[model samples]
Target: MEPIKKAYGYVTRTHKGRPQVLVFQHPILEAGIQIPKGTVEEGESPEAAVVREMIEETGLTEWGKPVFIADDRWKADDGSIHHRHFYRLDQKDVPDQWQHAPSGGGEEEGLQFTLFWISSPGDIPLARGHGDYLPDVLEERPEDGLGCLEPSEDVKQVYLIEEGVERIIGETREQISFEEGGTVLVREQTLTSEEIGDRRTVTRLMASTNRPLTVEDSGGGGMRAVYAGDHVIIERDGGEKRVPLHHLPVDTFSVELLLRTLPLEGTYALSFHAFNVLKGEEQLIEIHADEQPDGSFKAKVRFGAMIQWYWVNTETRELLKQSSDPAPGLKMEFRR
Candidate 1:
């Protein structure tokens, strides 16, 4: 069916060793926290709309070029179908931070918009369904959300894993290496003992080619899965098998990586091996991903009578927190 056209931009910058994204809170509208976006004008391309919207809303003179990421179609409140297009722009030479009032855009022409940056990839707020396709567009971007360290530097980050009781029990150190040809290597290992308990879970993941945003390889334990050119090959349990990449939006890797490749309103059937923890259970799950107003993505995973919610950072693709309500396990968070 034909749908209305709209375009949105995700502007990003790295300031003071911390990554951030540009967002604004609409003064009058219930739009909440949002990235810069607007309607596509007559005879205007979606790419052009993104550039215009960023300048109109944020008043940024140099936002670089906008890269088209993904698109989605949905019915809005007014019963109009909206075909939303999403793009990403990484801005350089931006001020540490600033605020601005819209210069023009008619309705918001003079309205005060405090243009600001939020912690990259972490959840911020976005109004409407404007944020649905964040994961799909930003998942393969290692620089946006995944923290990094210098090539010669060893430790990138240190995180503390706490149980529901909130006691300081275990710690994990993450190391990242960027090899030639765009392949990323991320390694994380932790130690916990009698005083420690086995409450903490650690995971290792990697992403795809610079363009098209695919998951090259991601899994835990001794298992390693790779997305070869035309198909996906899996190696586990002392054996390897190849699976066809016949779907439009492939969800073959870990749930965390798969979330980044899906549009805001996209849905995919996650298979048994898609989850590192559930691989041996022979479970097939469905995943529905959406962007919250606060800029974080909330992914709902369901299989039969069981369901789980994972809150992930849009920039870093990190699973900030997770919970299974009315089920066993306390709400778990990754704290630094």
Candidate 2:
């Protein structure tokens, strides 16, 4: 089915250690408060359309990076297909209350919207379920440490150690060591069925930097890798090759390293290697996080068709559980 292309931005900010979302209501229309969203123009990308909508609706010129959250095609009242792309952005400078007369020549050109900040966007009255993803976005954000955590020199830092056993057509033991701003290490030993009868392998990754370094030691075969600027340098079978970073998924091992380096607040772009090796390309993964009611934080990582959601504890900042798309995907939980 053919679908109309549309884009929207869920803009947010932090005031007094709490994350607040931006919602607006029209002066005349008795509709639910909605976000900045609109249709994509000819030859324009969804990413570009979202930013343009945000500026037109809110009159705000500065914002953090935008993370693409959800996109799908749904049927409208006319039975027409509408393909929508949603993104989340964080801005810290917007006032608590303001009025904006949409500046673009669009459906909302002359419409004036009264904007307000809400700590819990779910609690507010919205128009046509426009804020439906508030719960999901809020659930994904980290509760403590503002947003992404930064290394603190004054406070005493603690490391979290977790161990678990996982089965994926086979059984394997996993151990993860996470430090606030230090190196994160993940080690795994696996035995799985493949073309070569039974395969046993031990893999390790040092994901301390934006560029992750990985090494695998097999009984006979070994592989080594390093992520440089915009490319991944891999060594295997005594041969080396450089692959663009966008083609790889960065959260292959875990999200601990990504969390350590994320900006405290605002939109940001990140890169990671895919959990599984295929053909990798360098691309920017837009991401956002928010605190939950239970004091835990959640993060959303997007890499094209691959989406990773992480639930982390508030005290230890350790991963609690992870869910992802794609069959045979990585699903894990941390037990006390």
lDDT of each: 0.55, 0.57
Candidate 2: worst 10 consecutive residues by lDDT? 153-162
Model 1: residues with Cα > 4 Å off, grouped in runs: 120-122, 135-336
Compute each candidate's TM-score over C-alphas. 0.44, 0.44
* Stretches of candidate 2 exceeding 4 Å from the true structure: 140-336
Residue 317's lDDT within candidate 2 is 46
What global local distance difference test value does model 1 have?
Answer: 0.55
Model 2 lDDT per residue over 113-195, tens place: 99887777547777653664565355443333222433321111111222333433322334444332233344444433342
Candidate 1: residue 92 Cα off by (Å): 2.2
Q: Residues 1-336, candidate 1, lDDT per residue (tens digit)? A: 477888888887767865566777778767587888888988999988889888887877776667655554545788886777777788888765567787655787668877677763447746775555444443444453322322221221222333555554444433435432223334333434344343222233333422222232222334544433224445676776655443223332244445544444433344432322223222456777677888877888875457777776656556666555553554433344
Q: Candidate 2 has what TM-score?
A: 0.44
